[model samples]
Target chain A: MRDRLRNVLAGVLEVRPEEICADMSAEDVAGWDSLRQLEVMLALELEYGVRIPADAMLELQSVPAIEEFLTEHGAG
Target chain B: MSRLPTAEEIAGRRRQGLELTRVERPEATALHVLATFNLDLLPPFLTEAFDRVGRSVRPRAGAFGQLTQEILDPASRLYAEPPDEVLIVPAAEDLLEPLFSRPPSQLGPDEAEALVEERLAELRGLVETVLERLPAASCYVVALGATEGPHPHVLDPLAPERRQVELDRFMRGVRELRSLGPRTVVIDWDWHMRSFGWDAVRDERLWYLGRMRLNPTGCAALAELVARHAAAYRGQARKVLALDLDGTVWGGIVGEAGLGGIEVGEDGVGLAFQDFQRELVKLQETGVLLVVCSKNNPADALEVFERHAGMVLRREHLAAERINWQDKATNLRDLAVELNLGLDSFVFLDDNPIERTWISQACPEVLVPELPDDAAERPAFLRAASWFERIEATAADRGRSASYREQRERRQFERTSTSFEDFLSSLEQEAIIDPVHEGSLSRAAQLCQRTNQFNLTTRRHTVAELESMSSDPDHDLFTLTVRDRFGDNGITGIAILRYAGELAEIETLLMSCRILGRKLEDAFLAFLARRAADRGASVLEGTFVRTAKNAQVETFYPDHGFERAEDGVYRLTLTQGAVESPASIMVTVPANA
Candidate 1:
């Protein structure tokens, strides 16, 4: 689950897996913006086959939030 | 088509044309977009959409307003655009103004009928205007219906009935507008609405803030749909739908579980396979050739299509069947050769992921769509990809699957023949070479643009350009019509020649690969040489520009009694000599007639 979260973030951020730390947020990532936030949510939904409902994907800023979100959706 | 690209992602493709200024990029496949709202976010979505079909799209945007300027406007940014494909995405709100602004209860039937006519007429006029202005560009109109009516006003007694009438009238208007086919195609947003409903397509918040109405998902869907139209317009439609028998067409292994055990009946999970077969038959009716590639006894598999009561696709429905224990890739190659179609034209479907993976690695050109283990999702999975989209379905397109069957039977007869020449003479083939007219223009342009293997010089001309070439005295553009004993390979070959001074050059020479082994090229070239001599040409020169796929025709000129004048150019001196065609081929020249 952690690796998948890292990969998704890395894929969106165009950074290495190691570069995506736990404390990472939109401010920390150079390329992540509001538009990318929607893209990241869309990607997560496609990859996990579970659409993040209402404002749930909005809180997915840090790595922990994404992990928690995917785990709740029964996706790794 | 999978996911929309972020604005930051590939900032190069997104940021390149942000100025609304069109710059020409000759290499990449291009599409022009004319929209009512702000399409700032649509370009990257287009990039992502085109990426699915292995094409990188360079989209040129028109001015913001719908009726602002036509593509023919020299001052417009879209004037420099490729006239092959243009997308018209007029918002439904703009098209049907009164309907959107009012409640159906307030408006009586007479008013609704009047409004429908008004909307339809305006749409027709707009379409006609675009068609006249951009004669060459095939426009795909995104028909966004105002499907979301005002919430049921219970206070009004006859509101429901009026709404129904209004909806029917709207549909009739759309259908009538769409009837203007070939040059125009209306991509119904209803297809996308199925996945995400009207709530998702309409954006009230964005509508209030800016004129931009569609939500992000709606924008993505529209972009995907446009990209599909672009691919189809460029002759990239997948022609073959390859199906697997066991666990695919039916829900069981036919060898072990016999005909009765197969789950393709009127009930349970069997109904899913039944429905799936019906969908395939529908696709065949719309002109996609169906083929079965499975690993089972030929007779055993044949029984399913032969005798199954609930089966929608019978034995005759298939273009060709490869039902043996042979590997799929080998069978696929055999099918490609048999049908004379490129591997890129195939969409392979099998339930097993292993076989799909193997075929993917072996022949990456064949699209292997993933199918769920559950049979219910099979039809939807196959139908989801707009791989078989055609700009227009002519009579020739409809006869394609039957032509393949005839080719198969012809191939079988060839295997038992005494000699190659004997086989050639056996099939009585006749070719009618005529000037490119309206009916033949589309197919001629298709062969010109899409034909890579048999083409010399690989010159592509649009329909409008071909029309001019056909009319010009200096140019002779003819479509080759082939009919052997088996079937008519309609408008199979396209020859474009330029006659200037005493020398004539074969500007373009292409034949449909279906007629490859029939010794038609000899007849084709002979006819061209005779035409050139008639136009008072001293020499006929043909060039072979080698591409990755056209290596088979490297010695084309030399094989046909032409000496190499320069490196790639071959010259043949014109004489009152007769280049005898094969005895089987009876060439009909109108000049002789």
Candidate 2:
């Protein structure tokens, strides 16, 4: 689950895999704009094989929020 | 009839005209323009932009305000904008369905629902108005229906099903306008306006839209559609999507990344690249050639295709490839040459800016789409690009993906062998050529429009032309469907045989270039010769008129069993029997005309 989150974060930020961290939040990443936020949500859904409802995707702000939601939705 | 004039032809026409403004050209002798929209529905600026084109007018706007019990006769307005007097007539909206049956003050939620019903009713009226006001030989454009707001009101009625009822209703209105005749060309207004933004349409090219409104891309598409409709309406171009390895196909340069380092696995940015490649592979179902061109060594690229289980695009999927460090422009030229295609027929993609710019400067005819600066944008960018635009693909088109795959196998076979004739003979290539009947008319017409390289005379026809000809009782249409030892090449070639007095003339002879190397042309002419013999005709005639792209088959007549006649024409005598229907081939009856 951590690995998949890292991949989505890398794709959204257009950064190397090494640049991503587990503690990252929207403010922590330089590339996390509103457009990139939508992109990350889409990528996360595709990666984890889960349909994160539009509302849940909006509520997800930090890496921990995404991880907990993925657990709840059977993504992980 | 030949297929529509391409973008190049439109540009050529623009050059011939006296440039009144960058937008309007009046010098060309046959200058006519028509606009079809409720003028009141359009923002005023769009109408002004359209004024740049010669003699633009709309009937709906002038008549719209007066569509009440109070006003019986609608007014007309004229504007002198681009030195040409534009006559605008206000047609009575007897057809205009009222948006609100009751006063606006009396409207409730239910009233709003009723208002939508009334609007749809108005659309039917608009369709009737379109039929009455459509001008002769003038271009017509229609705006897509506007959604009332960001909310999904119209779609909600159809709901969960995504039934597209409102869309279909709008299309029905457009169809009624089209059924009126030649001058009506309906634009995909809804799709265009949403995608390109509305303001962009108003500011862009306007002449193509008739009097309707569209976004810039929609407007350009409208102009292209008009030009195509006016010239020859061929189905859309079947694309050969040539991809690049290293930087282009993946996130990083493959040559530098090595096999394991390359981005194409379950993790990292590779997943995005993998997803993109997989989508491209799916496009082969629609007959797009997935060819590979990269500066990496062929062996290294082959390693990715073979050993890498994670690789989405396999080696067999590519029809042709150029992996040498040769200039990509030159490599693309070689690929086209080997395949007997014009550079314009290709759409090249590479991630490296230097290589892309080189192709742009050198092979300017090829469409090199601008990739987004970021890696994540690759998928969305390609989805938006017009790389795949076929209107519809037949069974043959579906087989194209496999045919190209076999071509790669055939090329590998060629490398280890010596004699070209021996390779040709070993494949057991068989062609089934038959007279085009009502069942095969649509595919035959599509072939004439799409096939360029091996076409003897590039004549294009529409659905109407074939229908008219079938009814005429004077013409013969012949289609060829080939299946070799490898697989079925479904309707790869078509020839329209027209009976002129006692002579049979070949109006159009075209074959998909995928089956070019096989001796199918010989079999085709021989079959025609036998048909001529059976008919008691002495002379079988054909012509090899040259086009910019069809130079490959310029000597096609003389090379086969035909003699040169006066001025690029060819003739053959089939009084004697010709080659028997090649034993291995089977000609099946086409399912639909």
The candidate that achieves the highest lDDT relative to the unseen native structure: 1
The sequence of per-residue lDDT tens digits that candidate 2 reaches over residues B228-298 is 33332345553677788876667675578788877787676778787778777777667777778888888
Candidate 2 chain B: worst 10 consecutive residues by lDDT?
A: B78-87
Query: Could you report the DockQ of all the candidates, in the order they appear?
Result: 0.07, 0.01
TM-score of each: 0.78, 0.62
- Candidate 1 CAPRI-style tier: incorrect
**What tens-digit string does per-residue lDDT give for candidate 1 at B229-322?**
6666666777889988899888889899888888888898989999899889878877799999999999988888888897888878889889
Mark the regions of model 1 whose C-alpha exceeds 4 Å error after superposition.
Answer: A1-76, B1-26, B69-74, B80-84, B98-136, B147-183, B190-195, B412-426, B460-474, B577-583, B589-593
For residue B20, give model 1's deviation from the true position in Å: 16
Which runs in model 2 stand beyond 4 Å of their true positions?
A: A1-76, B1-96, B99-143, B149-186, B196-238, B265-271, B306-311, B408-430, B434-442, B460-467, B532-537, B547-568, B578-593
Q: Residue B472 in candidate 2 has what lDDT?
A: 57
lDDT of 1 at B259: 87
Q: In terms of docking quality, how is candidate 2 classified?
A: incorrect
Q: Which lDDT values do the candidates have, in the order given?
A: 0.74, 0.58
